[model samples]
Target: MLLLNSGCGTKNKNSFESDIIIYGGTSAAITAAVQAKKMGKSVLVVSPDFHLGGLSSGGLGFTDTGDKSVIGGLAREFYHRIYLHYQKEDSWKWQKKEEYGNIGQGTPAIDGDERTMWIFEPHAAEQVFEDFIREYDIQVYRGEWLDRENGVSKSNGTIISIKTLSGKAFKGKMFIDATYEGDLMAAAGVSYHVGRESNDTYGEKWNGVQFGVFQHGHYFRDSISPFVIPGDPTSGLLPEISEEPIAPNGTADSKLQAYNFRMCLSKHPDNRLPFPKPENYDPSRYELLARVYASGWDETFDKFDPIPNLKTDTNNHGPFSTDYIGKNYAYPEASYEERKAIIKDHEDYQMGLMYFLANDPKVPEKVRQRISEYGLAKDEFIDNGHWPHQIYVRESRRMIGDYVMTEHDVLGDKTVPNPIGMGSYHLDSHNVQRLIGPNGYVQNEGDIGVKPKEPYSISYGTILPKKQECENLLVPVCVSSSHTAFGSIRMEPVFMILGQSSATAAVLAIDAKIAVQDLDYEKLKHRLKEDAQVMLLSERLK
Candidate 1:
């Protein structure tokens, strides 16, 4: 059922052939491989990461599901298996079953009758992903880096083969680009866009920089000084605050939002590891946070949200908190070495902030005493020094496919034709840059928060590239949409839903001998319904 026709080191140096080839180790990547096997296809998953389940198996235990009823098919089956894993008495090792009470964002946590759970620990999620590979006998080639420079061989607008750095080539009839950065999509000569577009470009209201529209408490309420010497401009601005000119409202730019690690922490004495100071630790970097704390800001512990067994999924809290803003604008297109340096910088900054708050003498004693109780969870992320293996890349390159989904599609103003999946999260984006405000103080910019009027249907055309561009490739993770529209449809559950749907379409195209754009939607919708995928909310809940 599965094949690896060619070997790299020990055997012949020929090309390997398969029906389908998926190139990523994300949660969507695993689910797509599972769907390919169930649909009777010989598939292979060649990933850049050693482990699977990108963010879901990372530290993001607190899911961002807006509506649970919209999840079905292989995505729903994944959670149901997690529910069955907890039914056993031995599964509760760190904490007892009763001690792990039913606490979650929505619906019953246990759901004893339905046999499904929506929340779990990082390792538990990883185990379920591993089980999917074992149960279906899916062939996975790990630690194989893509040779992006001179790797892909294309002819007549179709990919003939893709090679790795180790000199192994994979020849397939169809390919799927499931990476968050869309590296494979760009290599295939497909058109894509990066960063925010102007409001006039897509007739959108929240696609550009928002100077006066402060959505949450992320902005400063009172005027705070940016210089080290209060009321003096000669001492120079602090480290993190920017000095760039703020653009007018609704204007376009090429800057991206911030990124951070969703750290898993614990308060238990036996399972906690103290946060150590990094080699390049500098206390002066957090002087701005010290100023914010002195100016009536005490929300540091607001986002240390709990998960299970006394563990907390800590996230970005306030203005000068976990998010490393204005530092990741070059990450999406950077080289591998450059990206590693950026990741190290983020790790050092976050770890240094924790140590400063708990040990530094300049910090207020009241705030330091409360934060000293928490540390990294010792049992989690054991292979990676108790740090999360993945950093949250919120937005990245988006393919400009046949249909560019705009705000009108999600705002319920126009009907989304050829529905494939459903998404209901808020149209959310973090602060892009922190620059000087109007009052000679510092303020955050580009934090727009807008929710949909209702759960709108997603279009099938958004995932298909132009027929002239490439006929054998389908992009689901980086689908065609504007910046504001991708924000609402970029949830983890929705990614898996689209992953399974795209896999179904790939096998159907392979069998029918047609391009992905030329396939009939009526047949695709029927196949999706047969697999228990929820295409509409009204029909799904019933």
Candidate 2:
């Protein structure tokens, strides 16, 4: 919960009030809070999470950093801290420092020249985020959920105060919605988008339904039937297969990309726990996966990206992998209870899939023998049954702000307005729906991968709401962007970059006593450069 306008006095002087109020406990939220505090503005982080870092400290430690040079500001500082942590001789417990070779997406994981580590354990990332909070002396209230139905209290197109589900109110001069879901922004009566828009809407080549485009190996290559009985449609469709007909290419729909857990697994015998059999584990739910395996798809461990100390950040790879496709479309607008149920369902599905692959008699003996050597890292996520506390929410509600970032912005075909940060990641989107294709074989759709022209600037307008809607709100995580455009900007490093930029704007807006949209771009740019944020690629080269 958050409050935008703060001219009036609160009912109680002891109530929590700050210059900037940030919602969410994501990596972006932490960075935003730190930036605000560093700028000499009191900031409060109202987090709905029990942990500090969201996915960065949760389990997705193998970073998705696209262009390391463009990653600056506190985002790079975080990786530097990780490097410093690993420099100590006592940090390695399961494997020696030298044993973890210097391997990254392209560059070395441990860059001595840059003094940064791109890959690390989940606990190490959490400690770095916690250290930032402690060093800055930022006030944080965990487990405070926004009362979405009636939490926001706005006066003259400005938020006055926000109350959480527990009836705690917070007041602030400026607010930053640094959440992955954009809950605070949505609750403030701001307009947002939930699903992919039509290609014609944004003039994007890959904005809508992608039916035949299979950039990754996550599509069916064999003629696998979707029925419970092979080739018998009357026997009913198999579990996890969509019965709806495939939509036209480039058409708009309410479908969402898949969600999954980035599991941190360890092969070390001393720090490994075998995959647990989840409650109500059903083997039939994975019948489509069995067919995929029978089709000679043996690339199960392709995405087991390694980090320090002999741990792997396991992600979705082949068809019917960890991604629970077509199951998260309702998550963006669902109630908190409904969202929890969806998360639990994903946990059970992934857990059952692991158990099936590791022990089921139907599984290939060679695959089972290999996967059985790895288990959950015993020291990570110890409080949550050794499982990740956060789910990889690849995409969610995107605010339609002052300007919507389109695919043209990502490709450098159109000039971005008010540069705040830059991202160079290839436009990557996971599979959205699994259904029967025209050839009567089950197939996956909406997996797209296209490299951008180059690193492009992200606009400050993308985070600023329309001046008429709200005057003092800034959104960093669920920013204003089209579907294909957000595919590039939705990385953790970019989130942190936007987080710092948003906080800087918030504090500057407070000092100027103006709306967030009315802040001078020149002033904002000067502060970002002063704070070491790389808004241009040429600056990094210098």
The candidate that achieves the highest lDDT relative to the unseen native structure: 2
Candidate 2 weakest ten by summed lDDT:
1-10
Q: Which clashing pairs does model 2 show? A: none
- lDDT against the true structure, each candidate: 0.83, 0.90
**Residues 1-542 of candidate 1: C-alpha lDDT, one tens digit per residue:** 11223222223554567788898888889888899889998888889887788888888877776677778888888878878988888877667788876766666566677677877778888999999999999888898767878778787777777888888888887888888888888888899988898999988899888886788677777788988797687999998999898888788888887889999888787888888899999999999888888898888898887676678788887888898989988887887788899989999999999999889887778878888788899999999999999888888888999888888887777888888888877788888899888888988987877877667778888888888998888888888999888888877888888889889998898878778888899999999989888887675642
Error of 2 at 370 (Å): 1.0
The TM-scores of all predictions, comma-separated, are 0.95, 0.98
**Where is model 1 poorest over a 10-residue stretch in terms of lDDT?**
1-10
Please give the lDDT score for candidate 1.
Answer: 0.83
